[model samples]
Structure formats: C-alpha cells, structure tokens
Target: MIWVHLLIVLAAIFLGARYGSIAIGAAGGLGVILLGATGAPVSREDIPFDVIGIIMSVIAAIAAMQAAGGMDWLVALTDRLLRKKPKRITLLAPIVTYLLTLFAGTGHTAFAALPVITEVAKENDIRPSRPLSIAVVASQMAITASPISAAVVFMASVVEPLGVGYLTLLAIAIPSTFLATVATSFLANMLGKPLSSDPVYLERKEQGLIELRGAHEYEERPGAKRSVLIFLIAIIAVVTYAALISENLNIISDPTLPRTEAIMSIMLAAAMAITVLCRIDPSEILGMQTFRSGMSACVCVLGVAWLGTTFVSTHMEAITAFAGSALTAYPWLLAVVLFFAAALLYSQAATTKALMPTAIALGASPIAAIAAFPAVSALFVLPTYPTLLAAVEMDDTGSTRVGRAIFNHPFMIPGIVNIALAVGLGFLFGSLML
Candidate 1:
C-alpha cells in the first residue's frame, strides 16, 4: 500500500513537471483524491492552512509594493551597486539577488535582477553564467533564511516547541546560507569558458546575434520610496513582534494572537497601507506580476502540501518504522532527503510542511532539522524552474545555455555546492548557537 501510494505522489510530480504553473497544485489535489479512493486514510486536519495564510499575506504585501514601483526601486539600487564593481559581478550578483529574496521573501524577485547581472557580466567580458547561475541559486536558498518566508515561518512553528524559535532559526539559517553562497561564487566564477573565448559566444558574435543592449535608466515612481519604506517597516514590526513573544523571550505571554496570525494581520495591514498611502488602485495590485505568481504559489502549496501531509499522516507508523532508525543514526541524511524532495516538490514551504513534522516525530532533533532546512532550496536540479530558465534566456552571449543533458546546465554545479556547503555550515552554526 505504501509503495502504491508513493507512486501516486510521483505521478503528481510528473504531471506538475509536464503541465507547469498551477497544474502542479491541481495535480496534487488529484493525488489527494486518488489516495482517498484507494482506501488510504485522509483527514482535513492534514491541510496546511497556516502555511497557506502566511504565504498569501506575505505575497499580498509584496505585490502591493510591486504595484507601487517599490520592486523597481530596489532593482535600480542593486544595479548601481553592481555597476560600481563590474569585475566582481560574479561575487556581487548572487549577493544582490540573495538580499532581494531575503527582503521580499520570494525568489521570483530574482527576475528583476537577472537582466542587470547579465549586462554587468557582458560589459566586463565575464561569462554571464558565472553570476547568473549562483544568483538564481542564492535567491532560492535565501527563502530558508527570510524572516517572513512561508518556509522559515513553517520551520519555526515545528521547531519552536522543541526549544528552537524564529530568531534562533534565522541565526542559523542566514549566516550558513549566506556564507555558503559567497563561497559558491568562487566556484561559479570558474564554471565555464570566459565570455570572449567561448565557442558559442564567438559564434553568436560572428552571426551578429550578440547584442549588449543594456538595461534602461530606471526612473523612480512618485511613491516608490514611500511604499518600500512602509513594507520594510511592516517587516521589521513582524520580526520584532515575533522575537518578543518567542518562547525564548516570553515577553508577551498568552497573547490573544499567535505568531502566525499576527504575521497575516500585519502584512494585510501593510498592503492596505501601501494601497492608501501610495494612492495606488487596488485593482492594480491584482494585476501585478508578483501578485499573480504569488497567488499561484499559494495554490501550489495548498494542493501539494495537502497531498503530501495526507499520505505521510496515513503511513506515519510505517514510515517511521522503515526510516526512523536510519534517520536517527545518520541525521545528516535528513538534509539529503530534503534536497531531492524539494527538487520534486518544487516548493520550499510545501516541502517543509510535508516532511519536517514527520521528521520531528521520528526523533530528529530541532538542530538537525534546522541544519537541514537549507536543503529545500534545491529547486535548480531541473532546468524548467522559472528563474533558472530566465537566467538561460536573458543571456544573449549564449554563455549560460543549458546542455542536452538536462543536469549539465550552468546552475547545477553552483547550486549543488551552495546547498551542500549550506547544510554543512547549518550544522556548524546550529551546534554553536542552539
């Protein structure tokens, strides 16, 4: 029965991979139905509504900011910083994207920075793949560290009762992932041939196909800075509140609103504030690309997490019986498992909600789980991911092209290095901190 049920989960992932976008969530919903029809126990309690709520609220605030031109403001700032040190774009690009994701709580923000990274690399005659590869990976990994990201939020919930809180999780996740990303930049710098000497680039240049059309000058909108300031203040408020009420602090005991609920309220309030203060139309927020992408992500989390949690709940006993001892003995294997599952799940929040609870039940310690949390950023394994494909497409020099062998792409090596080193550093940090 477990094997049969596992096939259904795999089939859902396959359908998601084939169809793309919201189909991933729809396929997951179908998997849930299949599980119930096949006599597997299904429970409504398995649905991760809290995780969904957190993601939706965060997305709303971010979308509101985007509608007000705040994202453009941020990109323009990063662009200026990158141009100052063109020769170090490989090291700087990922750092820029990483910080963007950290603030926005979504890797999709990397799209706004990708064009700039490519242009900087091209201007310096450096291979665009060097910066682009690590930039995409860094953006993905940053979700685990982002204070408001659904993945980190869900992780804090699971670990809080076990003596780890939100701030503690950030303490371990941020430094570990950030430093690993910086180290991987060196590896990314050496990934492919120099832009001038690469055969594909040379051919493209000979064919007059290599156009170095730089990004346009970005004019700040009337309310862009104000919107960004409002959103940043909201984020600070969320973090400050969470820290005060955390188990470690116990400063706000028995509060009527729990941490998750507080986050939703604060973000929704921030969205309203942005709409009113920025004088932006509410409908325009709905039309923003970030809103559409984010809402779609909410659906994906809903369906995939529901499907995964249902299956895991029904087979909890069997799963624990089969893999519990091994995991208990080699806790690091938990990170390895999460790394591959994330590749299939295609969502850090969904993967965390689905697996972390079960890991805790099987005797995995809080530190072990926290150390492994960064592994869920392995969304680059397949080339079909939006940001990964965007990196490949935005590079006109042909230096960032994907190979016929799907795994042979430029992002693979750098992404793998980042995740591996992050997991290692996570353990080191977790041991020292917690």
Candidate 2:
C-alpha cells in the first residue's frame, strides 16, 4: 500500500514536471484524493497555509514594485554595474544575483540581470559561462537566505516547536549562502576558455551564430527610482519587524497578530503605497512578469508541499524508523539526501516543508537541520530550472551551455560548489548560533 501510494505521488510529480508549473499543483491535489481513497490518512492541517501566505504576500509586493517600474530601475542599475566593471563581472555578477534574490525573495529577479552578465563577460573576453553559471546559482542560493522567502518562512515554522525562530534561521542562512556564492564565483571564473579563444564560441562566431551585440538597455520609467526606493524601504521594514519579533531578539511583545500577519499586512500596505505614490494602476500589478511567475510558484509549492506532507505524515512510522536509524549514524547525510531530492523537486519551499518535518520527527537536531538548510537550493543540479534556462537563452555568445551529456551543464559545478559551501558553513555557523 505504501509503495502504491508512493508511485502515485511520483507519477503526479512526473506529470507536473512534464506539463510545467501549474500542472504540478493540480496533480498534487489528484494524488491527495487517490491516497485518501486507498485508506491513507489525510489531514487538512498538512497544507502549508503559512508558506502560502508568505509567498503570496511577498510576490504581491514584488509584483506591485514591478508594476511601478521598480524592477526595471533595479535591473537597469545592475546593467550599469556589470558594464562598468566588465573585467570584474565574473565575481560581481554572482553578488548582484545573490542580492537580487535575497531582497526580492525570488530568484526570478535574476532573469533581468542574466543577459547583462553574459553580455558583459563576453565583451570583456571572460567566458560568459563563468558568470552566467555562478550568477544563476547565486540567485537560487539567495532564496534560502531571504528573510521573507517561503522556504525560510517554512523552515522557521518547522523548527519553531523545537525552539528555533525566524532570525535564527536567517542568521544561519544569510552569511553561509553569501559566502558560498563568493566561493562559487571564484571557481566558476576558471571554467571554460576566454570568449575570444573558446572553440564553441569561436565556431559560433565564425558560423554567424553569435547574435549582434548592443549595450544593455532599459528605459527607466518616470517614477522608477522612487518606486524602487519605496519597495526597498518596505523590505527593510519587513526585516526589521521580523528581527524584533523573531527569537533572536524577542524585543517585540506578544502582539494580537502573528509574524505572518505582519508580513502580509506590511506587503499589502506597501503595495498600496507604491501604487498610489508611484502612480501605478493597482490592476497593473497582476499583469507584470513578477506577478505571473509568483502565482506559478504558489501553485508549484501548493501541489508539491501538499503531496510531500501527506505522504510523510501518513507513513510517519515507517519514515521515522528508516530515517532515524540511518540519520543517527550519519546525520550530515540529511543535507546530502535533500540536495538530491531538491534536484528533482526543484523547489526550496516544497522540498523543505515536505521533508524537514519528517527529519525533525526522526530526531534530527535543529542545529544540524538549520546548518543544512541551504542544501534545498540544489535545483540547479539539473538545467531545467527557470533561472538556469533563462541564463542559457540570454547567452547569445554560445559560451554558456548544456553539454552533450545530460548532467554536464555549465551550472552543475557552481550549483554543487554553492550548496557544498553553504552546507559546510551551515554546520559551522549552526554550531555557534544554535
């Protein structure tokens, strides 16, 4: 029966991956129904309502910023930063991508910067693959670092009953992921040949496969800077409020509202402020690229989390027995297993919510789990992720590429390196902090 149920869940994931984002959620719902009919216990509380709220609120605020041209202004700034330091872009691009995901709470923000990094690197005779690969990895890694990110929010809640809190998780995630990105950037710099000397790029150049070059261009809307300033101010406020309320400081008194409420209200109110002050039409928020991508993420998280939670919760005994015995002997393998799972699930929130709870029940230490939190960013192990795909599309020089073999993409090394440093440092930091 357990094997049968597992097969159904896997089939749903396969269908979701095959059809694309929203299909995953639909398939998850179908799986839930199939499980219950087969006498597997299903609970309503298994749904990640808090994670959903966090994602919707953050994405709503991001969409509002996008509608107000804040994303454009930020992207335009990133373009200038890359062009001005083209020689150093291989190092700086990952930092830029990391910060973009850290603040924005979604790696999709890196889409705007991917082409610019590739182009700048190519023009400077640096291999575009170097920056493009690491930049994408940094972007995904930042999701674990972002305070309001669904993954972080979900992680905080999972470990909360064991005494971990929001800022504690952030403490472990931020510095670790940032350091990982830096290390990954250094190594990614050495990959492939200089753009002018590369066989692939040179052949493409000779074959006229290289697209015509132009300076990165984005027309700054009238209120772009103001909108960006307001959005950033809102982000600062969210982080500040989270810090005050989180376990790190415990400065804020118990309020009528939960931190999730604080986040939702702050983001919605900020969106309103941005809409009015930046002269953005509120309806336009729903039409922005960020808005659509965010909604799609919501569905993916919904389907995947629900399916994963249901399976783990229903089969807790079998899961606990197997995982507890194995993890007791080799605790660090938790991150290793999650890294591989994330490579398939391709979602930080979904993977964390689905598996972390079971790990906790299996006697996994909070500190160990916290230290290994960044391993969930391993989706870039495969080149199918959106940011990875976008990086490939943006590299007109043919330098950034998936090799002939399936797992031989340019992103593989950076993804592994970033996750490795993050997990290793997570253990180091988790010891000190937790």
RMSD of each: 1.0, 1.7
TM-score of each: 0.98, 0.95
lDDT (C-alpha) at residue 298 in model 2: 85
Model 2: CA > 4 A from native? none
Q: Candidate 2 — what's its lDDT?
A: 0.83
Q: Residues 58-120, candidate 2: write the lDDT tens digits.
A: 888888888877887787788888888888887999999899899888888988888777777
Q: Which residue pairs collide, candidate 1?
A: none
C-alpha lDDT of residue 203 in model 1:
91
Give one clash count per candidate, in the order shown.
0, 0
lDDT of 1 by residue, 1-434 (tens): 98999999999988987787888899999999999999888887888899889888988998999989999999898889988989989899999999989998888889889999998888888999999999999999999999989899989989988988899999999999999999999999988887788999999899998877776489888989999999999999999999999888989988888889988999999999999999999999999888888888888888898999988998999999998999899999999999998998889999999999999999998889999999999999988888998999999999888889878999899998999999999999999988
Global CA lDDT computed for model 1: 0.91
Inter-residue clash pairs, candidate 2: none
